[model samples]
Target chain A: MATQQTQLLARTLLTPAVALLFIWMIVPLALTIYFATLHYNLLDPGSESFVGLENFRYFLTDPAFLASLQNTLVLVGSVLAITILLGVPLALLLDQQVVGLSIVRLMVIAPFFVMPTVSALVWKNLLMHPVSGLFAWIAHLFGLPAIDWFNDAPLFSVILIISWQWLPFATLILLTALQSLDEEQKEAAEMDGASALSAFIYITLPHLARPITVVILIETIFLLTVFAEIFVTTGGGPGLQTTNIAFLIYSQALIQYDVGSASAGGLVAVVLANIVAFFLVRIVGRNLEA
Target chain B: MARMVTTRHKVISTVAAWLVGFLIFFPILWMVLASFKTELEAFAIPPSFLFFHWTTENYVTVQERSDYLHHALNSIIIAGGSTLIAMLIAIPAAWSMAFSPTKRTKDVLLWMLSTKMMPPVGVLVPIYLIYRNLGLLDTRTGLVFILCLGNLPIVIWMLFTYFKEIPKDILEAARMDGATIGRELIYVLTPMAVPGLASTLLLNLILAWNEAFWTLNLSTLEAAPLTVFIASYSSPEGLFWAKLSAASTLAIAPILVLGWFSQRQLVRGLTFGAVK
Candidate 1:
């Protein structure tokens, strides 16, 4: 009897959130679909007319679309790989008993807290400045010529900045997973004379499988939409070398004010993000349930 | 002998870990140091580490050139207000989902999360139009509402985890003693889950605070947060390294200090169930 009452309350309480989320989804898609089918613009309503699939065709055919799409994939995939590679080892290191580990943990996580805009500026100006930046100074001291990071290696530079910020998150999540590993299982492996690397490979790696997926899925979702780094350092340039889909959409929506093309691009980004989310739901959604 | 070798190994690991820690932290350290340098010293080709002439001129210029305080206030108001409002809505929602069991509950949770998966750009048109229609452009209230909406699913998910760890029988006993639903949520559930809720609040504030895309797009001048404040430093007049660092330092100092104080709670909350 009490369960029924609680269930009814649950339904009532969730009604508003569920309804609002639904509206948020439907209204946006409806407007996007409408815009995609027309030449809608904030500047000129008089020129509006039905031009079905032209915007889509133009967007799909544009080289900018494919370039940004490829860049987006590379950006997301590369960051995911770097963060995991760096994060897992860092997690293992931190999980071990160490003096000043707390302080070290604090230092590592500090990058994640810095606002993206500020960090991007810091990197672009202070660390990647070919003449005046730290990397330049280091190179000069080693008798090597300085590399202009943004001009020469825009994508790689942006990836480095992003990976620096996100590595802390991966580390913390995986470290938490590491700490939760069964002590007995580890001890059993040790008693069997298993090397530390082998133990980590067999036992610890499997334990972290879920979190690694989560770290990738969550990071991929954000990375596909990386903007602040691009906005600050490269502006998706050195001739559109670093433009991701999100930046591409922003240029269409705001820079060009081509709402029709922008909406179509936005819809494409949504479809791609949802595919990743579907996989994430299979992993993380089950964890939430458990 | 074996114990002594193990002790030696622990020492080596500690030293190695601290070195890695210093390397990771060196960039922010460089920025802060740059903020104190004169522009010439800041832009020195060799990148002055400690031998540079230090000055407060960049900070002074940053203050004179930009409305730093106004942007800081906006960052606080928007991030704090949004997270507070999200907590208000999410707590009750999480409570219901946590204490109540249903076949559809997991589906509901996943659905809420699916909304997060939708890229913000996808809905920029409709949202922008709606904001323009409602006169919410460049307004704190609009930014707060959107930010709150954006983080609500994560808020509920985190709160649900925290509340689930709490045994439901304790709340039931409160009900048996004639505690109303309101009394149960406010008096019983909240206090018990304070740590979890606190971290949820902290993490949400951090997420909202670092948010750049919405804060940048939605607000040009009036509602621009610290992200915009930092972005303003970029212009065609050649980049000013010292001044930019000062601006960046001012933008991040408050949140960074807060994170330092609450690192333990933040880590614990984030890793809540993932490890265990």
Candidate 2:
């Protein structure tokens, strides 16, 4: 029995975290919402005025906003697709009986640990550089021209780098989920004349559904705000080719010093992320209840 | 079914998996190898895979050139300080929720998880202004405070999950023996919580170390962590492939090792125990 004394003590213990998180969540956000309504530019200070809905209107109407919005969706959608699609097969393969599984796993998952900047730059210079990158050499080996990655397809390049960073994460989670699958169930499927492909499609896919949702939601949360990789690789460069909402807001706030519009964009980002978080919290909460 | 797959099938699967693994890992591997090469060799067309003139010069140069150690120290201070502070605030809270969960415990935990979903960009403008006005910009304390708050939810959540798994019978038994609450925690609870605490620390440290948004926005040169420092190399310095590789390698090596060690915990931590 949880004594009343212990419950009191527990509430006391929880207060600091609760109080701090409450402030952490509410204070800046309240400020952001407040700032979103004003025509405040940092460089032209002391002329702040309430310009209700103007910032949001401008932020929403700006062509760059539309481009960055599209870019954000593409970045998130592509990385999610790439990671999940490849991750499933990779997880299945790793789940198979294999030699040096530990070493293979370490090598496979190594990229997930690499810092975003490092992975982005490494892929940019050493692997994808059109001039002297490894891909150039590989292209030369086949007597084909080197396709400039960042220059030609900056958004795709960003997507590739992010997908690489996240694929390992997807695989590791799915593999962990896979290892817990009922071997008896698999054997039964096999005995019932299910081929490997059918067993995987019918049994394995169903088994992976929850973890797949977990991976997608978790990855979407991170992917939607992907910053460092784009920052290092493209700097949202070549005229907003790779600019996502995060970078767009950063440039607006810190670069252009437009507090009002940046705050508006920030709110927009908050709303977008909350849409995803709504589903994620529900799913994770369901798991908690279970 | 396991026996139905022949040795040949096993061998084929092994080869394919290893190839895929190596392909996935090639970028990091190439970076490491490039770190050991002469700058010219690092960028040579028809690149030398293994026979390049190996050098430790890039590692020496990366430090001597950019003061790599300074940024690395900032990373350590920021990541370590945040994780430490987070754990201190989180431990008791997680302990309470685990041991004496009330009707609101689940709601509280879910609410904490929701805070993590608040995109950092949403609050970036205000936080930036707040830091500027308070003159906390480019300070380790600023970075540490933000990162600690940013990660506090996950720290509490992960610790809660771990602490929940800890059997309450032991605590009840200690209570039945007339042990005081403090003594019960000291003598009965902490030892069991160590593994969970360590893994949580490791995971949080890794997350904080690689954290980019706040560190990038709030700090410049003085408190710049490796993330910001490495981002500086994105321009002219990035063209120097070997040096870039050396800097990147050094920046990631510690977190990589820590990450590998904590990989198991990572799934639980990142997924908020949804997968587990």
**What interface RMSD does each of the candidate structures achieve?**
2.0, 0.9
lDDT of 2 by residue, B43-162 (tens): 888899999888999999888989999999999999999999999999999999998888988999999999999999999999999999999999999999999999999999999999
- Candidates' TM-scores? 0.96, 0.98
Considering chain A alone, what is the TM-score of candidate 1?
Answer: 0.96
lDDT of 1 at B9: 88
Cα lDDT of model 1 by residue, B1-276, tens digit: 999988998998899899999999988999999899887778777666788777888878887888778888999999999999888888778888888858988898878888888899888877887898999999999999999988888888888888788997898799889998888878987789998888889888988999988887888789998988788776632358888888888888889987776665555444334434
The fraction of reference interface contacts (C-alpha pairs within 8 A across chains A and B) present in each candidate is 0.71, 0.82
Tens-place lDDT digits, model 1, residues A1-290: 87788789988877777777777778888898888888877677678888999988988889999999999999988899999999998999998889988899889889989999888888887888788788988998899999998888999999999999899888877887788899999999999999999998999999989889778877888898888888877889977799999999888888887889888888899999999988977776566656
Clashing residue pairs in candidate 2, if any?
A: none
User: Which residue pairs in model 1 clash with each other?
Assistant: none
Consecutive 10-residue window with the lowest summed lDDT within model 2 chain B: B1-10
TM-score of 2: 0.98
- Candidate 2, position B138, lDDT: 98
Ten consecutive residues with minimal summed lDDT in candidate 1 chain B? B267-276
| Candidate 2 Cα outliers beyond 4 Å, as residue runs | B1-4, B237-239
